[model samples]
Target: MNQDSKNKERHQGRSFTNETLFLKDLVGFQRIKYRYVNVLGMLAGLLIVVQAWALSNLFAGLVSFNTLSFFMLILGLLAWLLRSVLHLIRDLIASEASRNIRFNLRKKLLSELTFLGPKRSVIDEDAALSTRVYEQVDALDDYYSRYKPQTFMVTVVPFIILLTVLPISLITFFIFLLTAPLVIFFMVLVGHKAANANRKQFSVLAMLSNQFMDMNQGLSELRRLSRVKDARERLSSSAKAYQSTSMGVLRLAFLSTATLELFASLSIAMVALYLGLGLLEKLPWQLGSSPVTLTNAFFLLLLAPEFYLPLRQLGQDYHAKQKAEAAASGILQILEASTSDSSTTQVHLKDSETPQTLMLFDSLSLDANKRTRLVSISGHIHEGERIWLSGESGVGKSSLLYILLGFEDSYRGQCLIDGIDIKQADLSQWRSRLAWIPQSPEWINGTIRQNLTLGLSNLDSASIHDALEKSKANIFIKKLPNGLDTKLSELGTGLSGGQMQRLSIARALLSNADVWLLDEPCASLDQETAEAVLETINRVSEQKTLLVVSHDTHPIEWVDKHWKLTKEGLYEVA
Candidate 1:
């Protein structure tokens, strides 16, 4: 079998780690917050017994028509109220804990993503990664809040109820004990199936989400190529698969609930029958020394259902166990993908300390998707040099940039900075000394000043205005009512394409990096705007090293070197 098929088989098999143990490992149960949540839950379970005992006494008093019946009823109501309060507190604690855990998981996931950089190629689609990181991580809420604490309750609560029942009648206690295992056994059997189904369901959900995002993004291109129908059909297929798997999961959950209900009802009924017989003195032989009093009978009857309540709840939450397991599987998979391979050696450095001097790319090569994109490419990018690199659309221009940023590890040959191997340098420190401007710049929904000065702190207005002016972005900023303080929608939607590019250029310039990398900097802009941006870039390149990757042949009088990347290698242009 192929690797993917084997992976699927393993994922669907009955080989998962213990769900509770996995959660505990991720966020230790020894944490003070989680301990508080569990303690509250345990207290709530103990309250069930108090509530049931009070209700039983009230019932017995009403049957006897005693004057104390009113007081007993009031006590029962108070016990019920206290139980509700405990439950509410436990729920609030669980919610707070779940929120904290989700926050931590998201932070950890983002850190790993930053470490892996942009070229990890694990999920291939941003939508799929987002779904896993956002939705799948959030799905862990019920597992930690409900399923985990519930598991503890299932273990402790029933035994506590059993202790209360044993003193009244050992016969009733034994009957409860014998039938309890049947409910749990069936639950485990069905839960195993539910877990497998949930794993496949989540996989399909991710697949469908990725397809929908890709279709939406490439709709224009698909329509232009007359393949819109094909794209739509594939998306529909994935969506249908996800829907079918989801329904199957629901059916299993319902079936498990029904089966547990049947077993628990039977167990309760058996206990009730035994208690009633003992009260009527209908048993052939004695099971306990004390006769079954009216008070004891009612208590046992009330406590029987309470004994099974925790188990019943656990059965209901079996689906959550499955969901959490599936989410954990996806999360662990991403974490494993972030592990550094042997090909790249990481060296630690003090913050912001980067190597200086010209970087040499010697006999560099990379193969992706069975196609050789770069072959024996060799070149030098000296400090304080203005270089323009031109390449055809599919000649791996962006891939080379990724290499310099230490984002792509699956490549051969040496990238040297000051005669030290790039692999041995600290990537974070190296990145801190470089600035990148992509073909499409990303913008958050924030003020223009916030977008420009994202990573840096404490920039005076004069410096901000200076960078903006140099990039030619001040032209439009002056027209705006708020200028630098103006709020922008996502991706700077209110701004023209050229305006956004200039703002990105301004942001890059503000970084004050020694080396600047530009990927198709003026792509999709008008000739006038492109020329203006190029002129700004040319003026900035006088001091800093510049690596400009573009298809534009606009004259750059300030550039010192020019190269064109072809199938064989990079060639210096005459």
Candidate 2:
């Protein structure tokens, strides 16, 4: 690649990372803040202070063990009840935050998918996109919200308590201070390696997930061919891989935890042993009237366990934290993927009768690694200039459709609108002016009108009914009990191939696009039906530019022109 190309790629890669990973980092910090402060925080602070004081006095044996000491200890223990209540509240808050953050992040990721929908054809397939959206995105999101904040809290509050405890007693302070760092270091050495493996597994699982979803989406076709079971087995293997890698990470987490616990226990014992010797040597160094005694030793020992509690929990928290970071890194890689332009640009559609054509594509060609579609394609379409594209299957007709829509940018040649580079033209504006009808219209399970509208609004019933009737889509639609409002399955189970094609066209017509790109609009229809649909296209293209890609079938019996696909490129057919 040239220096300019490499620089552009780098710039885009950086932007994508910034946009995608910021969500997790932002959510993680905010979650910690919300849980750590407020009324609950104040109570935890108060409990720690009183607990510290009680243990100190108990070791001094200033109060009698009979009733006074027991009474004070009981009061301090009860005040510590706030810790339990705080835990419960933290869990409740953490649960909600996790769910919300996950939901929002997933939603954002899905929206970005839509934004990049056109450019996706440059990749091998949309299957990867689907997995990124439905599966991997969710897994990574779960880690972000659930265990992430816990990790932060474990890292934060424990360190704070360590500092607070150090001023009180050097022996107790050294025990936790020395051990916590070891836990983190040990976890990094072992768990970090596992995290790398988990990350690799996630990538393969993502690939397998996309393939499986693709296979499932095509299940009907696979079912006829008896390949459904094969697909299932394939997906099962991917699932197994994901499970084993995840298990490996979890196992490392457990081991790291065990090692941390062992070290903490040993440290506390050493502290206790040191204190026990100090008490035995109490008479050697008497301070005025009182010498340190067994009571004081017992009291310090009692305080020792609780001191280690905060620091020891770090081991467990480290595991959750490492896993979350691993998941976040995966998502971050995708989000940070560099694209040509990440900024939003606006370019509106041009009206047919408008003096200056708003958008134009002169000798446009799209080249991609997808499905061996178009090669060195070049064409021009103006408002009122209807065209048909004929090509062999797997020659990238659909890929070409995506290129015209400004999705794939890997192709050569410039696309101009009104003599301006479409590359710099606002994409959102350009897309707003387009209406597309795929060979198989997506039949989401919804009311007939919803299917017809595709949830895109603002079409009066007259325009909608007219488009449906002309496209031959209204026949089955009107037969339904609710007419346009009839409910349909996800793939329009009750509707035939022809009905699906027409409804999808109606949805596109509703978009009121200035340019229409159709791929095999009449592929599954009979001679008469295909002719009728062509007639509809002819009518629609009168005030709009229409680009059609198909094999033998040509829509618009009187299309303005037809372009035949050649091995080298596109050429106008006489």
Which candidate has the top score in lDDT? 1
* Candidate 2 per-residue lDDT over residues 328-417, each given as its tens digit: 665555454434453424444343365454445555555444434566665566665677888777666777777667666655667676
Model 1, range 1-574, lDDT digits (tens) per residue? 4333322322331233554555666564336766776687667767777777777787787777664666667777887788788778877777777788888777767666665566645445667787889989998988878887788788878878888778877788788889899999999999999989988988898888888877876777899999999998998899889899999999999999999999999888887777777777776686543367788788888888878888999999978988898888887766555323433445543332343456889898888778887777888876777788887887878888888887676778987766667666766668877898988776778999999999888788899999998888999999999988999965575688889988988888888887899889888788898888888788765678889998845655568888888887899887
- RMSD values, in order shown: 7.0, 5.7
Candidate 1: the clashing residue pairs are: none
User: TM-score of every model?
Assistant: 0.78, 0.80
Best by TM-score: 2
